[model samples]
Target: MTEQSAVLARPPLPDDGDLDLLLLIRHFELALLDLFGQGLLAGTTHTCLGQEYVPVSLRPLLGADDFVFSNHRGHGHYLARFEDPAGLLAEIMGREGAVCRGVGGSQHVYRDRYMSTGVQGESLPVATGVALHLKHTSPGALACAFIGDGTWGEGAVYEALNIASLWRLPLLVVVENNGIAQSTPTACQMAGTVAARAEAFGARHHRVGTTDIGVIRDELAPLVSEVRLENRPLVVEFATHRLGPHSKGDDTRPHDAVREAEAHDWYRRYAQSDADRFARADEIQRDRMAAIVREVSARPLSRWEPCG
Candidate 1:
């Protein structure tokens, strides 16, 4: 057995009660939609409208020392971890108060211990590198890379997985399989399942369906503990759907009736009574956004520089 695994056995699972967190994420995404519609945000933005549980499920499991690497559609991940919707809005608007100082926009927002990139399949390798560093420096820490189903075909992802598994790096690779990658459906993009690929790489793999927060908490909490304790690579494939388009102005693909119906059912089942909670959260976030808009507007238009 590895020294790290021997020293750190399976830890206790996190408690339930992530419903409030989930609702907060949902409202935050809705606010982003409002901001985008008002043209307050520069460049294209991707919102996790229906797939809030992917990040919300993982939030309680992560430690402050742990690292999170996200892909293009990663605002939910940032908000869930950092809980600073105003900072995110500022960054997306290219204001100086943004996490990246008006440099990295919606796709390239990064803060301490949390990083995201606009390119697909890029975060996996970077996250592996962070895991490698953690193995040597902070053996207790773990790194998580959030990628989409579209990124599965990238050679970089496999390369990172191979290295992580070979080195026994403490990494959790999360694939948010939302069925559609950009405008193209998953059927046209790739073959085989994400779990099979992880198995091929000799990493522990777990698959979960249904976006219910309680179901995800019950299913993922234990798996997250195991991954952190064993100090080994893990791949968790979350079967969810994206209710919104891939990005701004890219809603060409037809919606899946079955997925839509299922998503609605799940939301109603989980978030029905949370209307008051959502309203409260929404009001707070809206007020913060208003402040951000005013602050950004006060700045010279030239300060709204483009992000690379």
Candidate 2:
């Protein structure tokens, strides 16, 4: 099949959906790491590589009037809205030219009036506050928080859940439960299902597989509808996995090498099967990666800027 024909055959972009944007963001994140070597280098990076479709499918449920709060694993969340690739690249590179003024690097990037990165679960409270503020002024505005399964262990998460539920704030909390929290499996660490925990706190809940973007799209649409209509909070747990090491500096030596090989093989198969997206995304990523690499490499040593 021809190149465009292959992509056209793979998966049609959802009507009124923005999933492809996340695909572009994933490529951008990977390119930044591989080409620019500018982000979380030598340190573990919580990559949102395989989990691209979840945010893409879910983002349509959010309007510009809404707010998004992201976690350490939030590259998808930020790029879905702002489209500020250069600013993110600069922040990751620790250049004084960064969006956070170099104060926030890979995990700490943020921009006002759009989205916030850099702090874990920090968005939850901020989102909660936004919801509360909207309650006072424009109760129609909604706040969405994208957090990880690992962050479920944080006291802040539970506190936010309690506060949000108590007030019935128009909040949407999504947990990207990627099976593993760092090296520890979800079964070993997560106290219980995220949905169950949220339900116990009197928050409405839904759980869906992240692998199927369609399923997530269906799961979130109605919930967002309810939040818009009722001004309530909903907790959605997306069941997925991290296809790579936790971060850049991770030592996967103790993990199963066979599993790693299998994942890589699976990725290869998927890429090859989807002839159109693979070809297009590959070319786009390659070109972008190359440019970023050249830009970073050309920077003089004396010109290096650090985030505050």
Candidate 3:
């Protein structure tokens, strides 16, 4: 009967299926990092902190027959397609039970037929070759390769881009520009926009801000769809943020109190607004986070072993 309650009850909150996916992804990343604290990991790891939704939206566009080639920071991409979280944790830990059987550490994790190479832009040419093969065997399937802004300097990417366009390969290149290549920011390193570089190769291109979930769904859906439907190569640039440090090794930056406050403020606002209608989303997030904690706790760190 109160005015405030009436306003709240006027209509339910917006559907947040995508937001739910993001919550689960955040849980995954948090859990993996916790494992590192428990001494379950030996080699280095790259985190996809603020870039969860981009991969979540893009994953649905992929067909089961499609292939994905990822970069160093690719925990999100692998989890999007594959179901075995345990194997992923194991892979990062370098255990025999890992998805890649401990052979590939953080830089070389692979499983469920999905893979990420340590060498920057290495996957570009590999994915181009995969696309070429798919063109012959399974023309309907598409191949997606995810590279970071830092890797723009690599020669392999240009070679792959040139060949993919020349042959019209059915490949999707996603450049996740999180503003930094380690400590070096993109503004300092990138000479030109990634989309422009891809355009130079004659590839179809689109640039999307990853922070705006709505834009991500709208812009990327068609690019992914067209690549699958038309069997042609295309590239999408996702501008995102690195909410956390680059990795465990580096943590010496001056704390931006203002930025931290803003992040916390936004998080509270989103949580409060979405809690009423998208109740399941919140519940799923909480449950998944608990599950991740339990899973990591149950696994012993002593089992971890680097590749012989």
Candidate 4:
């Protein structure tokens, strides 16, 4: 781990609200795995797992008017933005209250100003275009897109960045650099760092090593403001971990790699450092998610009608 990431290996845990949000995402993801394991759900889902803090930290920083484009592993992104776990759960489970009427399932959810897709590198260009629109139509509202480090390989990402930089659009790219992409280690696929790539396109780059929500928000607040005020493209890369498999049962890392990821996980660190606080919060969310699963599963399938 980087020295910066080590700065908060122990917990003087975040405020209650932050802790709750983090655990909520954690438990929601855990429930997804359980549901998948038991054959309770169909279709594919990607859980953010250890990287939940990325969106949790940015939730308060983002405005409702700002556009958010999410990638495959974006449950954290959605939950953090809307805080409507029931809707998301229903969407995933194909229940009556689904956000997208059960058609989008896990990856292709759409709500006002927030959208997510299963395809890699697909959202950036769309986000870039939206940023341009936000720049002209809604001055302060920016477009933020979450992408994995593996997405750096896509030429469309670079194209989007070039236009975003040239047009001085309010584009914020959050890169979750989890070291591995699907079954491939990033070291095996990436030639240069995400920072270097963003710099090459004249977009500003910021590295986030610490998992502390307050610290991350404080650090990025100014940069985010810069994106809004100056209308420049910024890439904030998080040195994060993915504790679960790439998808369900698709992890290809060696045993030691998984152990290393676990060591860096914020959940483990917080639980170890302040068990009294962490345990209660974790248990509450876990149980709450369990209740949600039961409730959503019992609901009838959602019906979708084509718009006339």
Candidate 5:
């Protein structure tokens, strides 16, 4: 077996409850920032600093065999499923020890069942296709596509939605509406609401605030369960935000707006003390991650080999 495949064969993910998962996500993002700043991770990384709750909330509702299709800002989604921060950091740093053999970087990360694509709206169709396959072979399995509000303008997204709804496929389309798509705000990009479009497609849809994890879990657990059991399509629009700029070197918003956005972050509204706890936990995880990086960096790169 190839080295990448061997790494993929690591034991199954542990049963990480919601609280521990949240801490891990926060720490993972901080480690990414440190790596980016220290020049260890080459290329730009889209950090989901404030929006960590979206994926963390969704992780519990999903099964191990279920698939996740991620968009550009998908480090959280990848880590949520794989739970391999050291391997992910190595991937971003282009080390041979990375999960993808050091070729995918931050924009593209792929393992056996999880995938993150760099192109906007591209994963929508890919997820639709996967859902179709599951409908025929593994009726109990579900496929989820994570897209941003900016991708709403893409024709492929609507097409995928229509197709999934028509086929009654077990699909969950998650639109992470962070208000701003890159530097452009949602108001300037799309006219109608994402809910309206899903309605027109005859797909079940839900819109929820990102502040409360309980609210998210309460709303999604049944919907996800319904999709897997009934083989239907569901769309969940999470009202979240990008805590940082669109990506590294992409901060262009006014100072006042930035402050307002940060002030209104969902995590802040959820629990004031929790924020402090997260910060403290992040410091500890960052130190642990640094040690992991050092160890991974010491290993030789996985040799490249042709796939069968």
Candidate 6:
């Protein structure tokens, strides 16, 4: 047995619905990579492979009224919110029936209250402003922004956090800290910690270290409540691992770090704990993703004209 596997306990498989969403995202990302390789896709994509659990876990917690501002690695966040793989795939493929009509491509997508951006620190300020609007207009609704740990270097992030704290906006900042930001490690760039930065702005901060959806939701339930109803800004950072490269085939990490990420990946853990259930769900999603690729690929390139 591998030493890493020996130390890491098996994570319990989530329920049927949760398992389906998780695997759906997992397969969807894998399909994207395949498409990119085949020269069937345009523009670049950042897959949230190992970080799928973050958005899937936060799925049920967020209400339809809540707004989610996503960063570069936002496929999982978009999938969890809408579950429209075909539309998103079409968007990425620049095919007809895309959510943003192909103009947004992979990084930028706008659908009602959910949006994703490729910019590092853009979403935080926008989410903070939306949170302010929700506080007054929607009453109980909140605005959640999903950011990477690398975004901590951005001045706009601190600016938005300050405004969120000062205004007591109903904002939930979800940090997907995968350790590496693009090719650079977080330790190499970031000083102090995310918790400290959030504290500096007086925003409540919580760090999540487990992959269990139940445990994560249970721990954050009341804190989310505080953000939703009490008009407070909260930052929940997940200690996640990015299994895939930053965009395409550009993972420059040392061999050991990649192995460490693989060790903590939930895919093997779920399959190991319940092979029968995991296998069925995995097959279902894999097939679903394959079908989505075929159907979206056949559609004509999306066309959008600017207004005169």
How much lDDT does each candidate structure score?
A: 0.75, 0.67, 0.72, 0.92, 0.79, 0.91
Determine which window of 10 residues in candidate 6 has minimal summed lDDT: 1-10
lDDT per residue (tens digit) for residues 1-308 in model 2: 34223223334333323434655666666765574354434333466776666676676688887877777777777777776666666666655356775455667665654565655667788888988987777767788888888788778888888999898899989888777777777788877678789888898988774244565677678778898778789988776556656765463545674254235322344465666666666566557655765575454322445547
Ranking by lDDT: 4, 6, 5, 1, 3, 2
- Give the per-residue lDDT of model 5 (tens digit) for 92-165: 77666688887777879888789999999899899999999988888789999999999999999989989998
lDDT of 5: 0.79
* Model 4, position 202: C-alpha lDDT score: 92
For candidate 1, what is the total of clashing residue pairs? 0
TM-score of every candidate? 0.83, 0.81, 0.83, 0.97, 0.87, 0.97
The sequence of per-residue lDDT tens digits that candidate 3 reaches over residues 119-184 is: 887899999999999989987787889888898989989999899889888999888877778888
User: In model 2, what is the error at residue 292, expressed in angstroms?
Assistant: 3.7
- What TM-score does model 2 achieve against the real structure? 0.81
Instruction: List candidate 2 segments past 4 Å from native.
Output: 1-20, 35-44, 117-119, 251-273, 296-308
Which is the leading candidate under lDDT?
4
Candidate 3 local accuracy as lDDT?
A: 0.72
CA RMSD of each candidate after superposition: 7.6, 5.7, 5.8, 1.5, 9.0, 2.0
Q: Where does model 4 exceed 4 Å of error? A: 1-8, 306-308
Clashes of each: 0, 11, 0, 0, 1, 0
The list of candidate 1 runs beyond 4 A from truth reads: 1-17, 255-267, 271-308
Q: In model 6, how large is the Cα lDDT of residue 292?
A: 84
After the best TM-score superposition of candidate 2, give how far the Cα of residue 103 lies from its true spot, in angstroms.
1.3
What residue pairs are clashing in model 5?
A: 96-301
Candidate 3 ranges beyond 4 A from true positions? 1-17, 38-40, 95-97, 210-214, 252-254, 257-269, 276-287, 296-308
lDDT of 4 by residue, 1-308 (tens): 36545844585788998899999999999999999999988988888999989999999889999999999998999999999899999999989989999988899999999999988999999999999899999998999999998999899999999999999999999999999999899999999789899899899999998897888988999999999999999999999999999989888789999988887889988898889989999999999998999898999989988787
The regions of model 5 sitting more than 4 angstroms off are 1-16, 266-271, 274-280, 305-308
Clashing pairs in 4: none
